[model samples]
Target: MNVNHSNNKITETACKITDEICLPDSDLPRIVIIGGGFAGLALVEKLKHQEVQVVLLDKNNFHQFQPLLYQVATSALEPDSIVFPFRKQINGYKNVFFRLAEVEEIQADSNTIMTNKGSVSYDYLVLATGTTTNFFGMDSVAKNSLGMKDIRDSLNIRHMMLQNLEQAAITCDDDERDALTNFVIVGGGPAGVEMAGALAEFCKYILPKDYPEYPSSIMNIYLIEAIDDLLSTMSDKASSKTLKYLEDLNVKVLLNEAVSNYDGNEVTTKSGKTILAKNLIWTAGVKGQFPKGIDKKHVVKDNRIKTGSFLMVEGSKNIFAIGDIAAVISKKTPKGHPQVAQTAIQQGKWLGNSLLKIIKNESPKPFEYKDKGSLATVGKRKAVADLGKMKFAGYFAWLLWSIVHLMSISGFRNKLMVGFNWAVSYFTYEKSNRLIIRNFKPTSSQTKESGQYES
Candidate 1:
């Protein structure tokens, strides 16, 4: 994606952070986390105990379950299902405090962190800010593509997709309608694969039922990728099965093709094939998103912060990082663990226990990541799961995935609602909440800015 200047109009809407007034004046060790994503939230949950003061900083007041965020974008799940209030999670823990502030910089020498609202001193700092979409320096893709890192991105994509469909309905021009109906998704990871698969289902069944106006075959969804296979992390059999499933659904799975460029109108691939489409969702790659003051060497290949086995930054012992942000060097993972939610949760626990040891005046132990396998759901009753030696696919795998995801939600109410939605969708082949509450107009004043979030 290409880089350009961001409009100053809507950049300051992350959250109006309050002052950092929660820490005690005594010498209790303080832990400051930079993000509220999977890794940082996990750290806070693990560190809720005696002998330490914890201050968690995030751009948003809620911790977003990013794994299911694509569902929110695609409207398979609602917002509340995948999002949990950060303050509510630790409301009863007297030792924990949260501030809705993005860490701007790290004053390592003074052990202080600078934020939009204010600054605070910390005995330990954890940078779990996670990653942002990597446009790979493609100017058009950078400016016009939608990345799926947070809820905002997903909602924006949903609006854009719906808006395109609506626009395709009335537009007199065939080229315009074709472009509106054509959707290009670049990337073949779980996010990309799942999104493409879901969009296909929408095109195949839901759209036909809902919009009886246009021909159901008007939708042309293309899953473009620079890699040869989707779900590179999964086994070859599983990947092969998914590829066949996608083809069976009439999805164009273009492998080993780079999205050379995308202007809001058309996307050109490295193979020189020009695809006309208005909806381009970019999930290609992500780079480490860290604040200033960390050395360049400490930053890994993807801009991730390089940390020791203990997740402590090389130059600073007290300041640490984990999950997507932490580039851990260990015997098994010489670089670091994948930036997944499970890794973040496990790291959060490790950091919590490490703090416990520090309070007891004992040396912190090295962190180890526990692998819990991986899974991906492709449309209705189609899924795959890999648990170490065992691999499963099809409807049964999809059922297992649904159950596991439902139980992993933060609140019981959310779990119930999500479970209900899943059952209803499974039984009826319909999404009840497809109502486009707000019309998405690209570049119009109605289009919410990238930084905008509910206050």
Candidate 2:
């Protein structure tokens, strides 16, 4: 959508082209934010009542609760329970506008952004664009394996998994069935661990009841990690306990191993180990996603844009960045903050206030991050939490994990839906929303193109 800035001078030529998506000419400064992730969401909330005209742009119109995406993938929760629409999110905010478009590149020199829709110049640009799954230059893995970064990715996984299971249920070929039933998760981080645990739970609880023809033993879950232990970011105690919990649930943990390739049917490891599996999930790592035009000199490893202590892009004055895309280097965080929701939220809020101060001609404060601890759920009633000096596991950690994630979810409707889904599954040991609403084809592997329709 076009944004009209009356305060700034613009050529008549530019105005004519952008009139179709025209935004009201406003005296207040215009702030164009690139993403709708945690950082962008936090920034929008902070600037909701501010004088500036805010334009929030994202390819998807909804903000997804990423942490629980695995639950959606595993059929423990539906997609609607985790997604909040952008328009509904900013309904009461008069200054905010939502646009559905894919950003092509940042024309920093012209103080404008080129999107799929058209060009829109900005007074201030905030790059809260998050990261994309890093396949580490493995083209074969990228093409063949699945990565969970959003709702679409999660739905893809869900479809692939169910389709494979259906094929296994009817297949006469042993190898084909084995390949369909075997699950390989690359990376022992929270995403990988939680996925492995949830899949294992599906095997133990759901398989016997639903797919009674297939023995639960036929299904195998494997968690492979390049590191020596799981949850490497957390304490050693927490990591060890998490490993134990997964093992107790019968998940095979492969440590200090790197995946070399995936050929659609089999995964080859660096150590020459091979596991035949049609479903390979790659949550190994992620790199910041941004368009060309940011100087390569300012771009660091993992494609992250380097930002100063104030969250401003190093070389540009008005262009600022936050969240996973911005590498804000400090004495405490030499490598920049961890790419988590907390880092994004904190940076966004700090930058929001800082921008307000700058707008008012006051000195802005430097960004500071507050560590609120880390939590990851394993299987049913099993979780690990590292809260500074205190570490906990088992029931209490699981409880805390549930509460925090539930409260962090966007809308009250979503919270209630997710809570109700969890309660039903918790007591019944049966997931109610197992219906495949869409017909998924393995070859296409996309919800939009997989011949999806009402089942």
Candidate 3:
């Protein structure tokens, strides 16, 4: 494609060269997407063989199944089983192209985006950049703790956990051993609840077999929530049942408590309580992440870009936003739609189905979100579900959760691997191979206090 440099401030004597990223020359309107999350991929799938050319740019080449990251961290499933490559996803889509690049800024005035690699112009830009972990400006806690937001974060947690358990076995000091084996997960959301449950299962099933030196009780799992209940987004029955399930599994559930600080070895809560722990996982909050250049006036709560009912970004003619980054503000949804996979998928598909019509100056129906319901698993055979008016928990709920997630995975191979792993775990309680292939080093702040165990 030809580079557009008409807006650049160029000097006559300076050498002129095209800084545009090479792409196939096409007369069709080019649609550039900035993420490969559930929303972006859904849009790509919808527009694969359409008249428009779709260019997907992301920092990573793989689209990760986010809901099962806890399993990977707890060694129940391997990482590869949850992440699928973009190239493989778009293999037969002739109109689709994938590029590995981290976008730096967006030049909306010129319809150009600047990435680490080079620049690219789009006829229509879709911002699906999703979100990043939110620490709420806690520098100490942010430096010491790990957040499970991506595949690398999950792997880091896995390695940190395995390495800490090994260190706990090697250490003779009771305090240090306690610090090394202790795990504190902040937030009562789905991610935090699932992670705590998985860790508890690991302590129950895997610890006894792998680390015989220490009793399974030696490893403590604590789940802390700032609010009064777990799974606050669900119903009262679900929240209470989830609390009971975790407690039954010996997970310490601390309600109405918030972490104030962490110095690698100790965690201090806002209520003047302290717990000695080396491992802390933060799943409390997240904020939208996108390349710069959108008008600051249009940015709304949770760092999201304001969009109209048609999913078009405010104050832009051809720019749109989807996924968690886009907030469709209206009288009916004053706080915007729920930032979930269902919402993202629905938005992406809606935009994809309507884009061509929109380009032809034909109006399509406005975007509407349909809630598919919520499901959260506490442990094996224990889960909670809220599907519309019906609320349920126990084995049936867990089964439903499993079926939904298994079918939702991107690839057949991943589904098979995950299904096989789940079946083995169901029968014999055997998990994936826990191997420390590479050394995991925490931030400098975490390493300075305790070099022996850093997670």
Candidate 4:
């Protein structure tokens, strides 16, 4: 395999070859990875000390723990506690290199990728590039609502939520204060359910103490889902218990309703009901995100690239797509695996080993996802879990959820900080990180479009 290198570092691409970016010339095959998400990171770990030269590229310099992003939005945990620097994460790996750049196009024919910085070729190209928020073609909803797919979006939610509460506290008009305090969270998935519970906790514990001038009763938290129940992916018992938990927390649960549009100040439902809420945290859906140059025929529903049983991109030999961007159809999984962290991690690790096997001219194994169960935490001592054979709900499940997430987060410092914060919040029932460090005002277009995660 040939790579365009100048001065043993990346420079620039000229005439479909190398550009400004340069790397050390080596006889080993070069594997270029697009995206630094869970899948990409897993691949990096699996490829450590391998013969091939690896290049990891991402739009952001840091990898944020997406699961805990809701905590940041709710002021339960600080942003730094969940995000770790990518460079530092791979500090001692000499064969691996990380670059900060946005991929603009994929030249499959030439085994080259064009980024904002330049172009580079890969012997084997892996796309672990994950998903972006799906607005469902609702331009108004996309333009007006806030999404929770990234750290920036969580920060924006934090700022906007606190700012609105502050404004509500000083407002004399009851209706205006109501609108400012009314928080509408669309989508009844884990993020929406957990976020609603957290906001309700804020109203019960934080708001009463922090905003003594305003009555906490006016702070309405709504959890809206289009389906018949919350956490539709979970078992019926789990969903029923979850609804009970949310109701017990006094969160208004609206089921069997879809949000049709949002005009910054109002959320209109498909049933023609209008909710006057300044904050609409959309956790509805996400679609695969990739650059141009791939044939449209290879793209499947939700913008995911279709992959063969071996996880190779449908029409390409040396190219593979994994994580949320890949739709690997089989008899067992006709649509695809659920877009979750476990799916991505499993795919990455399997692909990493498979590549080595293929390099040795040995047969690669077909991908199989082992479902390790699912967990969702609602509020203090309220959670649900589906362990396949067994389904449980309540305090024990919540504890399990906490422990799993605490262990899953990156870095000892981050884990320590998050644990300490959770401990403090659990005992005191007050959050100190409510201070709006950065003021965020949503634009007419993207509200939390910072390239780290979707807003």
Top candidate, metric TM-score:
4
lDDT tens per residue, model 2, 1-455: 45443434221233355423555566679899988888999999999867888988888888888999899999999999999999999998778888887778888888988888877778899988888788888878877888888877788889889889999999999999999999999999999999999999999999998799979999999999998999999999889999999998899999999999998899999999999999998889988877677899999888888988888888898999899888888788888888888888898888889898998889997888899999999988999999989999999999999999999999999999999998998898777567777865544243121110000
lDDT of 2 at 428: 85
**Tens digits of per-residue lDDT for model 1 on 1-455?**
22221321111122334565334343467778787776777777787765667788777888777777778887888887878898888987767777777678899999998888788898888887777777777766777778887787888888888888888888999999999999898998889989998889888878987778898888998998798888898988789888887888888999999989888899998899999999999888887777789988778777888888888898886888877777887678876788777888888888888877876889987787788998898888898989899998999888888888887787777888888887888888777577677876555222222321111
Model 4: ten consecutive residues of lowest lDDT? 6-15
Task: Please give the RMSD of candidate 3 to the true structure.
Answer: 6.0
lDDT of 2: 0.85
Q: What tens digits encode model 4's per-residue C-alpha lDDT throughout 1-455? A: 44554323333333345484566556678888888888888898888778777899898988889998888999888889999998999997766888888888988888888989988788999988888888898988888888888888888899999999999978898878888999999999999999999999988998888888977898999999998999998999899999999999999999999999999889999999898999898899888888888789999899998998788998788998988889998889989898888899899899999998988889997999999999999988899999988999999999999999999888999999989998988888868567877777888656434445211
Show model 1 residue runs off by greater than 4 Å. Answer: 1-27, 443-455
- Judged by whole-model lDDT over C-alpha atoms, candidate 4 comes out at 0.86
Clash number for each model: 5, 1, 0, 16
lDDT of each: 0.79, 0.85, 0.89, 0.86
Ranking by TM-score: 4, 3, 2, 1
Off by over 4 Å in 2: 1-20, 442-455
- Leading candidate by lDDT: 3
> In angstroms, what RMSD does candidate 1 have relative to the true structure?
8.1
If scored against the real structure, what TM-score would every candidate get? 0.91, 0.93, 0.94, 0.95
Candidate 4 — which residues are off by over 4 angstroms? 1-18, 445-455
